[model samples]
Target: MSAFVVAYFPHLCLAFGGLLVLCLSMARSVPAGFYPVTAGLFAALPGLWAVAGPQGGSPIACFYAGLLSVIALATIGLLARYAKRRGFAGDALYGLLLWSALGMLLLADADDWIMLAVGLELASLCLYALIAARLDDNLGTEAALKYFLPGAMALAVLLFGMALIYAASGSLEIAASLAAPGPLTAAGLALVLIGVGFKLSLAPVHLWTPDVYQGAPAPVAAFLSSGSKAAAAAALLHVCSEVSPEAKELLWPALAVAAGLTMAVGNLGAVAQGSVKRLLAYSSIAQMGYILMAAMAVNDGGGEAALFYLAAFALMDLAAFGAVGALSAEIGDRDDIAAYRGLGYVHPWRAGVLAIGLASLAGLPPTAGFVGKFLVFGAALSAGYVGLAAFGIITAVVGVFYALRLLAALYMRESLIAHPAAVYATGPAATLALGVMAAGLVGLGLFPQTLLGTIAALFGGA
Candidate 1:
């Protein structure tokens, strides 16, 4: 019982924290500001700390739990920052975000098929509600519908896969079942891959990502990209690694093709978008391609590379969207690249933050994004996927072009648009968040060995 409690502390915190927030909301005295979010944040800390602490000696430090901690913190930061200006469903958002994070943490550490299935449903259902919460936006409603329906179908496929696996192996524990053998088991694993492809936004099945991200709130879109996707990737990596390799020979090639297609489609789709948020939505798909490439390299230092990239990716992506979210409040929240025309003069600091984010996203030097790319590409090359590595490099270069468009728009001139005296009440918190991300990006890039060494050690145990 103690072992389970320690392992699942984060989920417990989220559950209790969410209930408290919901009660406060219903009482109609939940404060008109960021207090409820602050309370939630405070409540969730023990769980986050417990998970982050090197106490368990479990070797595998629950990737889903750690990722959820990161996401929960990021969401807390975003909610607190946004709560002051727009009082739109802040309490509900906070509670649901925690609930969703709980689901993610559960999904991440799931060692069995049933646990994974339940976790996936919990996270997906929360997201469906969140996507539909933007009452005034038809786009939000439509996106929720589009995402929800397909998501349901994907869940069914995943459940079916689980059933097949159980029938073949007579067990749901992934590690144990992987040790068992049969052709039916192989087919079961293949079906699982198909389901993962849908959630991970791999090609053909990724048709939902762009529309959903474009339609959702900027912060929500960022969560989907950074938090939700990272959790899914982590789970997928575990599944791939623990499962039998007989299917890997066939699976790897298909994933590689999907990675290439995802990058090509994501980048190409972004090139024509007028909206910054929409462009980012497409860019996200492309970036997922890069991450997927690393995932495919799992047998050869790929997991470490993937984890490293996930951390770097989350920091930079969140920073980008944070800047967008902050500015959106001022400029009609449209986040069109053109809307940012000459923003540098009006909000120099925010523009600088945005620039750092974009440069990092472009995989430019001195940013952690570059080091992340190098690690992934190196892993791919080591695995003899040289062509895929080359494609990643090419697409990364192409990404720079789109990222620079923002800088160009900013540097041109100051528009007549009035700079709203923004009340980022937790100015220090916001600044600290950006600084942490920026510093991590540069720090990891410069001294890549330190992080790699740590990750390598973890990989040994994983």
Candidate 2:
């Protein structure tokens, strides 16, 4: 019993915490601060497990569990501040966030296709509710409708793919599905990729991303962009790890093309966007393109690169969105780039963090984003995808233009309107979250060798 407990403690911790929050949510007079406190405690459990040395699953699982914990904690922190500012009171909102985090934890640890599907649906459903939580906004309702329709379609595709794999191999285990390959199995794998691609916002299926991000609450968008996206990428890495050589021949080419298209579309779209939230949405799509490039390499080195990049991207994205959330809370959700005119002069600190995040997203030096792109492209080059690597570099340069454009608006452009009676102010809680993420971005960029060595060792052991 102790061994079993040790093996599954991380999942159990998150699961139990989620259930506890749900129960509290049902109470007639739950404390105003109860949700954030419990959620923060839940978020700490996986880090505690990490500190004690994970005793279950592979080292990769431990890494992902730790990653999920960090992302969840960050989300909870941002959500608490957002809720406080906007009077967004609801125990159900906090409960849903915890439930979604639990689902992500489950997804990261899934060993079989069935578990993967369950986790995906669990997270997806909670997100739908969270996105549409603001009952008064028609735009939120529209975004929820757009998100749900495609999500349901993706789920159907995933289910059909799973059924096909089961029929072909008579087992739902990832290893079993990969061990035996027939035409049916190959088709199943393709369908599965399509489903995962939708979740990751890989192009051709990513139309929902910008609209949803633009309409959803800023804190929710931050969580969606960082935590949810990282969880999906982790699941993609797991699925790709089990692919047979026969399957690889079919998968790699499709992945390469998708990567190129996703990068081009995402970067070009960001350049055209006038809204900060929409711009970040497109930037996220391009970042996923780079991650997919790493996935195409299909080896342990590739997986390590993908995971490292995901961590870097998560921190950078959270920093960017946290600033957006703070600004929106103060400025009445006027997320237009024009609203930010001369912000660099007025709100220097917040603008500085936002600039750093955008610079990092552009793969500028002295930020983890640079290191992440370097590792991802290096993984591709080592795998002999020279043309694909070149394409990625070109798209990355395109990404730079838009990022700098945003910075230019922050510093160069003059404000067209007068300041409101209340000056723009970021709360201490939100500021702390932004600072932590920025510090992480710089720290990871400056001293990545230790983390890289650890990732290498973990992969080697597995």
The candidate that wins on TM-score is 2
Q: For model 1, name the residue pairs that clash.
A: 368-441
Residue 185 displacement (Å), model 1: 2.7
Once model 1 is optimally superposed onto the true structure by TM-score, how far is the C-alpha of residue 292 displaced, in angstroms?
A: 1.7
Model 2 lDDT tens row, 1-462:
898888778777887887888888878787878888897898788877865665866565677778777777877777786766666666678778877877876676778998888888888889988888788878888888899999999989988998999999999998888778788898998899899899999999999999999988887888888877888888888888888889888767988899999999999999999999999999999999999889887574688789889899889888898888777755567989988888777777778888989989999999999999999999999999999999999999999999999999889999776645336456565677788888888998999886777676666633
Provide the lDDT at 121 for model 1: 80
What TM-score does each of the candidates earn? 0.92, 0.96
In order, what is each prediction's RMSD in angstroms? 2.5, 1.7
Report the lDDT tens digits of candidate 1 across residue range 1-462. Answer: 887677556667778877666667776755745544454575456445544653452334444455456556665666566544655655777777777776776676678988887877887888887777677778889989989999989888888878888998888899888666677777787778777778778777888987898777766767777777777777787887776667676567887888999888877777787888877777877878888888777867788888888878887878787778767776776567777977787777777777888888888999888888888899899988999999988888888888888788877855656655553433555666666666777788788887667666655642
Model 1 scores a C-alpha lDDT of 0.74
